[model samples]
Target: MAWTRLLPVADLPVGMARTVRVGLDDVLVCRLDDQRVHVLEDVCSHDDAPLGDQEIEGGCVTCPRHGARFDIESGAVRRSPAPVGIATYPARIQDSWVEADLED
Candidate 1:
């Protein structure tokens, strides 16, 4: 897996989502808490809308375009209108930096 360092952990606020570019792919990085973070594809499966700026609530992210909500941890479609789940990348914090495996 090609793990790319996205940003420092301090740059990401807890309970918020940030969009980072790894090559041509746009990844949504959600910092759930002090010890957990999730990385997901920044696009909605249903309408191809950007999920970057969506709000993170209770481990779920609500798509701003059509109100489709997805679980940040598993990338599962929690609310309908989204027929499929989005892609999730493995993420880790090392040396106080957030890294995401984009190889998959």
Candidate 2:
């Protein structure tokens, strides 16, 4: 796994997510709080729709298109309309920047 710097910690607002390009894939970088952050694939598991500009609560992100809730950390399915779980990456804050361990 290769760690890539996506953005600054200050750039990601708490309780929100930002989409970043990792190689040819779009990943969602979510900041749960000042100390916790998670990364997931940008697509919804239920449908082929993008997951962003949505609401996050209780460590899950609600898919805007179908309202499927997915756990940001473990990529677990938290709601219906999603037959599977999303893919999650290892994320951490390094030198005031958000870094994710993604495939290289």
Candidate 3:
């Protein structure tokens, strides 16, 4: 898989979700802690709403449109109203930047 550098780790504050355009996809990036970060698609599975800027609840974020909570790291569905899980990318911190492999 190819890795694309999204943004600097310092720009992503903890507990805040940021949206970045990667190719034709809108990617959601969130930094949970100093050593933990997550990358995923910015769309909700239930109603196609943007998942960006959602508040972090532990390791998950709830869809504002439908209240469907999903794990930001693995994209697993944690609450109802979502029929499926979101898409998560393999992410890593390289050279002080957050990089993600969007090609999957």
Candidate 4:
């Protein structure tokens, strides 16, 4: 397991998601409630839409293209219109910076 620094914790606003290219993967890093961080595949399972540009509500993010809702923590497809689920990455905080590990 290799970890790469994504961004500073302060760079992400609460309840918002940001897109970062880690290695060759496009990952979405989200700052949820309680300043918890979640990292997931930026692509939406419904039609391969990027979730970084979508809208986030509560702990879920809605795909802007097809309106698919997914849980940021578990990568679960909470709403229909999307039958598949996206990949999730493990994240951690170190020295006020957010980092994520993805199997490449």
Residue pairs whose backbone atoms clash in candidate 3? none
Candidate 4 lDDT over residue span 24-100, tens digit each: 77899888854588899999887887877544697898888878899999999999788988888888887888888
- Taking all chains together, the TM-score of candidate 2 against the true structure is 0.92
* TM-score pick, better of 1 and 4: 1
> Model 3 shows how many backbone clashes?
0
Report residue 88 deviation for candidate 4 (angstroms): 0.8
lDDT winner among the candidates? 1
lDDT, residue 98, candidate 4: 84
* Per-model TM-score on C-alpha atoms: 0.95, 0.92, 0.93, 0.90
Q: Which stretches of candidate 4 lie above 4 Å from their native place? A: none
Q: What are the Cα lDDT values of the candidates?
A: 0.90, 0.88, 0.88, 0.84
65 Cα displacement, candidate 1 (Å)? 0.5
lDDT of 3 by residue, 3-103 (tens): 89999999988887888987787999988988888999999999899887755888898888878999988999999999999999999888999999888
Across residues 10-81, which tens digit of lDDT does each residue of candidate 1 receive?
999999899998788789999999889899999999999988765589789988898999999999999999
Clashing pairs in 1: none
Better of 2 and 3 by TM-score: 3
> Every model's Cα RMSD, please?
1.0, 1.4, 1.1, 1.5
Provide the lDDT at 86 for model 4.
82
